[model samples]
Target: MIVTISDNNKNKTIEIKEKKLISTILSESGFSFSMPCGGKHICGKCKVFAKGNLSEPSLKEQSLLQHESKSDIRFACMTYVLGDTEIKLINKETEILTDGYFSQYDLNPSGINYGFAVDIGTTTVAVYGYDLKEGILMCKDSFLNPQSIYGTDVISRIQSSIDGNSKELQNVISDKIQKSILRLCDEYQININLVDNIVITGNTTMLYLLLNKNVRPLASAPFLIDDFLGRDVTASQCGFTHLNNANIYLPRTMSSFIGSDITCSVLAARDLIDDSKSTLLVDIGTNGEMTLFHNNQMLCCSTAAGPAFEGVGITMGVMAESGAINKVYLENNNIMYTTIKDKKPIGICGSGLVDSLAVFLSLGYIDESGYINIDKGEYITEYNGKHAISISDSGNSITQADVRAAQLAKAAICAGIYSLLNEVSLKPSDVDRLIIAGGFGSYIDVKNAAIIRMIPEELATKSIVVGNAAGAGASMILLSEKCRIENEETAKKAEIVDLSTSPYFMEKFVDCIMF
Candidate 1:
């Protein structure tokens, strides 16, 4: 049961017994990998390259590997352990630099008044432990979803559930989270029975996966969700009975695609805007969901931005994990980058794409319209063509095609912002603040985000990316009753704007692509 992860002198080992699956062992040992849809195998995430007989991959793993490479890579969640094995680990490229980002709150460390707030993202789960009285976070943990074998997008996973694998997918995610709660329960030396409660926020696909509900309706139009907004339920209902009837609170939702996760983000970010102010709250992911608050009312919508921003559906793209080329900086009029974990740059993440665009613009390489001049004579060579435009030199390296993919992704977000603003009877400059949510958004530089034309240029300084706002919002509900009621009310007051039905959406997407 000895497993080793090595990529040079760096080595870490994790031990597992005969009964443990390969997925559990990896997360237990703190190795970083993504299970973006809770290990359903649908997202083709939680991918790994193993050494030894355990390396032989499943058929589903083969298809996922086909997306990344033709070689013998495997899905860790789907891969079983016949024996001990060695696997290279892929952690996040950047550590959460907790600078002046979060306002320091005084937390009471006495006794055992703690709560767990969870953000169930399609790609990963984030758990935050908070001290009740002091109202400050103590520790945080995250892991990949085990149900990724089913599919990547929610629709595909819903289809997989139709074949009787649905319950299994639900168990994968619930079990992983249950164990994470227990781990925090033990690490903080707090009795699980005494812990306050737990809160969860995620898109409809995630909520249904946790509830083990039939999601067939969500996949097809009218695409109605049985219950978009949620109610307080016992731990047993969410398969968390192991915590002695822990209470689970979920945020309200608007639609099948636009779920409570975005609502939770809006609640957390509402403070970012003041009264007599016009602002927008954007939570971008595989589903680019957003809300606009103007004149004391809220209107919302969701755009099918797809997985391109999260590093899916690209030849050489990956989640924001280690070894991803995070930045392309101009030094001495030359472009150089530092990869995640300081290793050789392999693929690029969403933030990396934003940073790449910023660097290109800062050096006058790419125009404001996001077009890279293919004229070899127009730009100086960088690192001797290690990174080039209108050319190819490395495996899965950035190309003109990749630029267009990023364009589409950014266009969807930008277009959504503009459309939402227009509906509010205002222009981009009229907004007082623009708040960005999620770890991906928080990690990206705001000025760079605007320079690349992701948001309005005039509002660059006003934009703020709140790290794990969904998780933070859920954390607030875990401790306070006022926040819980407010969360549900927010969902009801929200006007779900269906951008998919908008005739102007296609036009906006095309227009944003030009810049």
Candidate 2:
């Protein structure tokens, strides 16, 4: 059968087999769609308009439609293609953030031939191919984590795994990585056969799920992990036959919450950690994982910042992709904004969301208590059937709930930072270097972040953006045995703190809810 997709006044035709859902057909046609609930008929972000022979909407879809109060709209994921159809996507295309902060270090790659350094994040995956013998990065690629269809956070993903979706999660991630490796090889004019090793870094749950390990241990109290130190396996064992001989190595984890991603990030910022300067390295996203080094001791903590910082669970929120608003500023009482790749604004990203809140707070459109002055109705717009302040003239907006989401996220992150400092008996001023690492960290305006009090104003001057520190650290390990050894030692020395159980954590988190 054939399916015609209408997007932005442009129509494209796609061919599909019988019994395929519109969501599956659009995915096969290379059209980007957000499946925040992982195609489970929940969250209801994957909306499309279909006019043709198609199966009836399921009870779930019907209920969702009624709740949305939109009769013409349908859930693409819930609608099956019974015959030829035309589908108009109501959801905007989402882009993934590939840029991040990585600390620069000396490398000696003469001992190695070729390898891959992969940073498997909850929302996105980044891979860097290195020609180790020449000490040069050959190619890099990144994409949205396909597992997002199941849910946006690690907990939801863990639930999916516990619900007997381990193989699906494993296959989706593995397939994406394998395909990325192949494309990287082809792009760099290098043969896949010459690649000798692959080093991967991710949070504990991500690495666990990628290998199809049980996640029940991570879901409840007394959380335990099967492997803190990842195992050595062949590419074939992970189902990648193209590099059958390649050694797939995953870095060790610090705790159930603190995974190899933090370990590798620590490796990237190794030089920045010394007695002369107390350093804090924070990779901000769904989980705001931070590591602080002072007097040769390392303290690590993970905060449940939620998916809001990554643009999930917000009305008109999107990932850091093309057409996503990445910046917002006020000029002569007029709002000025910029989007990623200079594309037309579709929605706000994590950085953009931060910028919007900061700008709104500065302009008095929003109150200190996170209230939007209803008197400023000129700046308020309707969004998803609710009132939201206009962040873009193109009808893109930030709702009160969006602000609340940001508040919850920033409160967790700031509280974690505060508790870490309190534990060390140091002030924000004591931090000589505050290295911001991760995709969100890369694009966020440090000034705006401080303005919103998401980050303490005291550290504004010391804050440094290091793009893709985890990926670069993975690359460093791939190129130099020294980096690998140092990371192992750092993992051993680093200590993990469970903030959820801390007595002072709840009090601090509540205190940080206001600007």
Candidate 3:
């Protein structure tokens, strides 16, 4: 059988002798397809347009596709290609956050010709290329992490690794990074052999997965790691054979959950970590990692916020991409929305979800307890037997379950912030500045976030969005030896607070659940 896949105006055809899932085919074909639920018939996000000799849709697939308007739409994970088939991927160009704010540092290159700094995020991987000799950044690029085909969040990916797919996860991410590096080199007319240094940063699980280490430790109680990876190895050891001469350095992680990304983010925002004022740094996503610097003391915590903000568990949620509703507001007593790039609305992203909840609360469509009062609003509609508010004319709506998911995510993050503040005997108003880092944080509206209680109202005015500080930190480490040493010191100064054992955190979590 022949399988033809089309993505971004590029086509690739492959031949297979037996039947296979479209997701497997796409992965084998080196296509970046996200199966957030690990092909378990959940998430319902692996939709593709295909026509040819394909197996009949399963009952679950039929139910999942009921709301979709296109008859040709099918879940890539559920569909089987039995014969010649052509699949067209709805691969929207994602608006990745790459820029960030960082303190100035002198250039001190560890290598002579070229270097690359990579920030491997749970949802996305950003790569930055530089001219080491002249201390200039040549180009930067990013793509969806290919390991997402196994799952979305770190916990899910860790579970997948424990289930005997460790090497597979490692190879996919390593290959993707290598491909990104080679592409950057080709685009900038740089020599691959001269790329002498590479610095990579990510969460503990991500770095462990990249190294193909034992993930069983992270899957259970008292999650402790035997190797806190602040070591250097050859690029060939990390599967980057093309850059055989390059030295790859992995930054040290602070804890089992709080990895080097937070370390780098803290390093990037060093100016705020002053003795004069208390500063709170937060990176919100599936996993909420935060650090608080107060009175020469540093405290950090990690909370499982789930993938609701990244559109994994929400009913009509999606990533911040073209056609995704990125903002929502009320104008003249009517709800209004705008999409990224002013494109037609497909679904709501994190920022839009927060805004939607705030708007719903203000309009009385949703009570303080999060119950949907559909009859109170003219745009209210029913979705999957639950009251929902329509966002567009094309059947996109936010269900009651989505609101609860957002509430849970927001509560986790908000409670974490308060717990850290409580430990320092400080209030939200006592903090000097709240530094919000990461792609999702960059686009969220501070007012709406506080309106839904996702962030404290007192700190909303004090929030600063620092885009991809981890990437910036990675770049800093790659360029300056002083930053590399400072990052290690920053990791050592952090005191991890285990939230699971904290009754205070539990109290704040319950209280923050209510908007």
Which is the leading candidate under lDDT? 3
Q: Please provide, for model 3 over 1-515, each residue's C-alpha lDDT reduced to its tens digit, 9 standing for 90 to 100.
A: 98889998679999999999999899888889888788888899999999999999999998987888887898999999999999999877888999988888889978889999999999999999999878788999999999999999998899899898898898899999999999899989999988999999999999989988899888887998888887797675676657787889999899999999999999888876677899999999898899998999999999999999898888888888899998888899788889999987888889989988999899998888888897885879998887898874645788888888888999999999999999889999999899999999889998999988888999999988888999999999999999999899889888998998999999999998999
lDDT of 2 by residue, 1-515 (tens): 77889877557897766788777776665554567766776566777888788889888887777755455677878988888888887745455455554556567642357888899988878888888777777788887777776678899899989988888778778888988899888888878888888998999998888888778889997887767865576675565646775788888888899999988888887666666778998988899999988887799999999888667777777778678888899899788899988998877888899989998998888998899886785687776677789975856888888899899999998889988887889899889989998888877888888888777888889988777788878877777777777788888888777898987778888888888
| True-vs-predicted CA distance for residue 80, candidate 2, Å | 2.6
| Candidate 2 all-Cα RMSD | 3.6
**Model 3: CA > 4 A from native:** 392-394
Clashes of 3: 0
lDDT of 1 by residue, 194-228 (tens): 67667888888888878888788887777776676
lDDT of 3 at 436: 95
The runs of at least 3 residues in candidate 2 whose Cα sits more than 4 Å from the true structure, single-residue gaps closed, are 1-33, 40-42, 47-51, 56-74, 85-111
TM-score to native of every candidate shown: 0.80, 0.89, 0.98
lDDT of each: 0.69, 0.81, 0.90
Separately for all candidates shown, the number of backbone clashes (residues 3 or more apart, or on different chains) is 29, 11, 0
Q: Could you give me the TM-score of model 2 versus the true structure?
A: 0.89
Model with the higher lDDT, candidate 1 or 2 = 2
